[model samples]
Target: MALDRLPAYVRKLRNAAGEPVYYWELPAWARPVKDEKTGAMVPAMRNGKPMLLASEKLGSDLAEVHRKAQLLNAALTDWRKGAEGASMVPGSVEWLFQWYRKQARFTSKKAKTRADYGKLMDMLAARETKKGAPPFGKRRAADVDAAAADRLYEMLRADTGPRQASYAMQVCRLVWSWATRHYKVTGVKENPFMGMGLTSTAAKGNRATSRAEYTAYRAKAVEMGFQSMATAAALCFEGCQRVSDAFGYVDPDAPDRAAIVWEGYQPGVEITLVQSKTGNPVTLPLFEEVPGEGGGVERVPLYPELEEELARSREATRSATGPIVVEERSGNRYVERRMSNVHRRICDAAGLPKDMTFTGFRHGGITEIGDAGEDDVRPVSGHKTLAVTRIYNKANAEKARRIAGARRRHIAAIGALDEARTK
Candidate 1:
């Protein structure tokens, strides 16, 4: 191979196989500088460290190496001009994203949440407007009005799907709002992603799981050697708890990524827990006071079915002080993703609805309380607001039955006397 004029700073080396390898190391000028105000080192580029792309990425390809080297050289020139000349345009959607991601508001989110948002952001940043036009991300954030947001949404809807489009826009709206408040990004007067009336086709993705479906699914789960899953479902349904809160979750922000323990359970008394999402403390009594046959109040098991399942699980795992929802195969706590896969399989085998999910079980529990005419469900569901709790409360047969009973009583009191005529 003839040694041609290669771009500056792009070193060519020989691998063990005697193959030519290209490596790019940051020159002193392209390295990070300490901010005078914050006294912290910030890089010129997103990842401006030495890279082994010569051998690893563009291995043995001289032409491609030259191309990448040119790009790096260009990046170095841009860094010399500072933030205004960087590839990420100032006041652009991508710029806002970069700014937002560096802040505590975005960094403090759950690892999974940050990952999900990052995927959406990358998609938005990469999606081209036309055959060769720049992506939507390059456009100034202030230029994206409500109408422009809608246009972008339609593009996403056409490219992806309704649910995904809606989700992407929702994330966009969040980023925009954060920028307006904290970053105070100039030229961005309002958040266009807001009030776009974006409706999701999968709005009911987490539909309420009926009691019959819950029972059938539990039976199928146990039959399929997933007794732990069945018990976990019971806990979610009976306690109206999120899977992460009930079984614990892998939280990068948390110390040691703690898992749920059985220390809070007092047999035949009460169970206490703090919700992972909201940090709302919850204490559910084992028994509830209900009207007895003789008229006086009597204590009955609040969730008899869940109680039975817990008793069985406790007996099976006697002296174990780990997670309450353990995967039987591994004897470890169930991660929500794997648990969801297993739940889907069980639902399929049980002939349950395709949309039925572990989340739906929690939705069902909250709906059950609403159907039973509970005035305040926050204490039971551990919801922070009435509005949020209401989102899970779906119309059901129990609610209709109550309404019918109320109508009958009203008719009797009014002396309509139309029962014989109707018959």
Candidate 2:
């Protein structure tokens, strides 16, 4: 919490409990004064003297402090310039985007997500049409129809690709919906970007990795002295965790980094996790058993590879204090990009496909569950709906085999009945 890095006109003070709190204050010149006759707060002056304004209390959370401070700064600028300081022409797409950025929905998104959306917005504002008359951002929101949105999508699809174009349209659709519902954006009734039947190509390169490929990748990683990477991949494949969640990164704001701790894990028993992306509580079992026909239970290790890898990692870092997946060279958690690079190296050494990414392992794990004839994958996959979980069920070989066997039995029964009737 550096004082110089904080926004202008913000003060940091300690509360009674010794916790820091933030507050925003406006300059006397820009502050609105209360009128004696109208009993209303308005910008005015009496005897050429400026009135004092109370400081606004921003929460102690640093992120919240920054968001509130930004909005207040915008207000201060508008007040200082009166009617002349509007950032953009009202009711324009550019204006809408700028406004939307100030809202909580945009500010509260993950940093990576916000940055991606920012790039798309900037591209939209700078893109030129064949006529070269004006950029799309300058167009009035009121004038934009479904046809105009379609043209914009087509232009983006041609310039970039279908994946990028679909994402851009999705973002615009959300912005339009938010503006329409929250603010009375003039002449903007229907959302033009809605229901465009967008088909995304985001999943084109990320095909599910096979179990054999995963095993080879892990073996290669371990041979290359990337023991942490090996365990991280296992977490993605066996635990069905995202890369970010599995190999936690250093958070500058927090005292401790987010990762799997030794306390949550009980080898050959169970492990608990609260997924960062969806905030869903996931408890994964390391061992399972089912009833056998002979009145005995057949034991199944839920994630035997992961369990063994984690055990080895614990033994190596027995004296060190931190996450389970610490770099052997450095006793720190593997950053997401570093992990991905190591995974690529392992894939090349293992003679696997170049497109086989660490993310695909998670998909592979879910698909394996589906292939095993699991009725519900939402619990382990942390998906809110069966629909979302079904997307990862790529290998339908077992399902097809079951249907084929049923059809064969039906044909055989039909032939027998027909022969009996003839006799």
- Candidate 1 matches the true fold with a TM-score of 0.57
* Predicted structure 2: lDDT: 0.68
- Per-residue accuracy of model 1 over 1-423 as CA lDDT, tens digit each: 344876678778899999888876677655656544323344444342211112224456787676656555554554355335568778887677767777788888877788778678766765666544566767888887887788789988998999999999999999888777754555566788888887785766578987668889888987898877787788788778887776675444663544445777776666665576666456666654569999999875556667677777777667357667776765666555667788889988888888787888888877766665564556656676323344333332233223323333443543445565666
| Per-residue lDDT of candidate 2, residues 1-423 (tens digit) | 453578988889999999988989876666676544323344443332222234689888887687667655754553344323465477877667767777899988875577668667756754555452565766787678899899989998998889899999999998888877865654578889999999885857667877778888888887888878888878887767877778776443333646776777877777765476676556665554668879999765656688878877787778334567776756766644456667778888889997888889888776666655564555666666322243433222223223323333443565687899999
Q: TM-score, each model?
A: 0.57, 0.54
Report how far off residue 417 is in candidate 2 (Å): 38
Q: Which regions in candidate 1 have their CA more than 4 angstroms from the true location?
A: 1-93, 108-113, 132-148, 174-202, 256-260, 266-304, 311-319, 366-423
Candidate number of the best lDDT:
2
CA error at residue 223 for candidate 1, angstroms: 2.8
What is the TM-score (0 to 1) of candidate 2? Answer: 0.54
Clash pairs, candidate 2, are: none
- In angstroms, how far off is 108's CA in candidate 2? 4.7
